[model samples]
Target: MIRPSIPDRSDDPRVDVSLVVNGEKVMRPVSIRMLLSDFLRHELGLTGTHVGCEHGVCGCCTVHIDGKAGRSCLTLAVQANGAEIRTIESVAHQDGALHPIQQAFKECHALQCGFCTPGMVMNILARFEEEEKLDLSDSGIRDMLSGNLCRCTGYINIIAAVRRAAELLGRA
Candidate 1:
């Protein structure tokens, strides 16, 4: 487990947050207004959950909260009390074997700049795990990725990656 490198600020108003993160139990006292993204990145030292639009429109801070994809930047640390949060750090095998979705992203060349990749993977991974069968068609894939925005690519490769990920995960 990666130890948190941030120093605690006791002077700020804080709330006790206890939650399971990437299969590890984390209990911390964080500022009441701290965003879940900030808590994950700063308090717990999970940097995979990126923060892009601070506004939740970019989807760069997506994480699995109680098994559903949610924008971590839009969520408060206190709001996630007792919730199970899964960051992109947990997607791959312990030995560094990439998750199928991550492998698909690489094989399909779905990322450029790689800023939005983690959130994109987390969102797609949730759908892949929850749905029995996903519609891998172009329109369907676009709908699935509607929440995320990528500035580098035209999304042609991203859509293709989603299809490839479906096949790799046996969802197709």
Candidate 2:
């Protein structure tokens, strides 16, 4: 019997990361310098977390780390070890039913080009989940969305979607 040769990667620096992703526990070996966004998208195949601005200025890579919204692009995979990470992929039901936030976005036409939709939804979802009372006023919504930048839709629809989502969540 012939034995297949396996390549050794011991010389390359890597760290074992363990975390709960989309309610499932996962463990993987990632490069020491790998960004959380890259780890999620490339290693875990969760591409919903977009990488827009590598500098983390754009909110295109927002995700829930330990139930708090954070920029995945700015976080290292090793730093997220033992943390709960939720990406946009976890928003919908297993049967493909859209979450209320996604429904609101669709009803209000919050997205154009759809590049920023995932991050926007994740950011808004975190706020809704964490806040006891949210300011639904236009200015208040603007304040909440200050971190995310959307070139399309001019934010008018996005703001409307936030309010609609709140109403759907019974938080309005």
Candidate 3:
């Protein structure tokens, strides 16, 4: 039997939201209470934006919203209307070439389980894009990456990869 759409509760009405995702314009009907994380993962099939802590603590749901990284778990799909959202899927080139950051992560062995890599990379991208002079100092890098949590790798190579990514980005 075909499943019918669930009725929207009064407090959770459906609304249309428009956003440019990964360089493509998209519009979808989403429940007003739908979190951006869910909208991106379920509705749009972009699973790279992982939702770790639904409360936004783990930072696994980070995404670039209008050129800045924001916790998708805390952002509503309706609130993202008319926004430009970038997910980790956009980090790679269309011809299967890994973006420099991705290559750095791979070559440096920055990821283990890889659950947090997407958010981590997006956060790094946000910092690099927003800052005038990229600071890769230990303390500076720690402060920028403090929000993202990874249980593996002990962050040794991740830090190294971030530094390497900075160099790669600088060469561009």
Candidate 3 residue runs with Cα over 4 Å from true position: 1-11
Distance from true location, Cα of 91 in model 3, Å:
0.9
Q: For candidate 3, list the clashing residue pairs, or say none.
A: none
For candidate 1, the lDDT comes to 0.91
Estimate, for each residue in 6-113, the C-alpha lDDT of model 3 and write its tens digit: 345547668989999999999988888888988898788998998887888888899999999999999999999999999999989999998888988998999999
Per-residue accuracy of model 1 over 1-172 as CA lDDT, tens digit each = 2535445656779888999999999999888888899899877778889888789999999999999999999999999999999999999999999999999999999999999999999999999888887888899899999999999999999998888887887777
Off by over 4 Å in 1: 1-11
Error of 1 at 12 (Å): 3.5
Backbone clash pairs for candidate 1 read none
Clashes in predicted model 3: 0
Q: Which ten residues in a row have the lowest lDDT in candidate 3?
A: 1-10
State how far residue 115 of model 1 sits from its true place (Å). Answer: 0.2
Better of 2 and 3 by lDDT: 2
Candidate 2 residue 100 Cα shift, in angstroms, is: 0.8
**Model 2 residue 24 lDDT?**
93
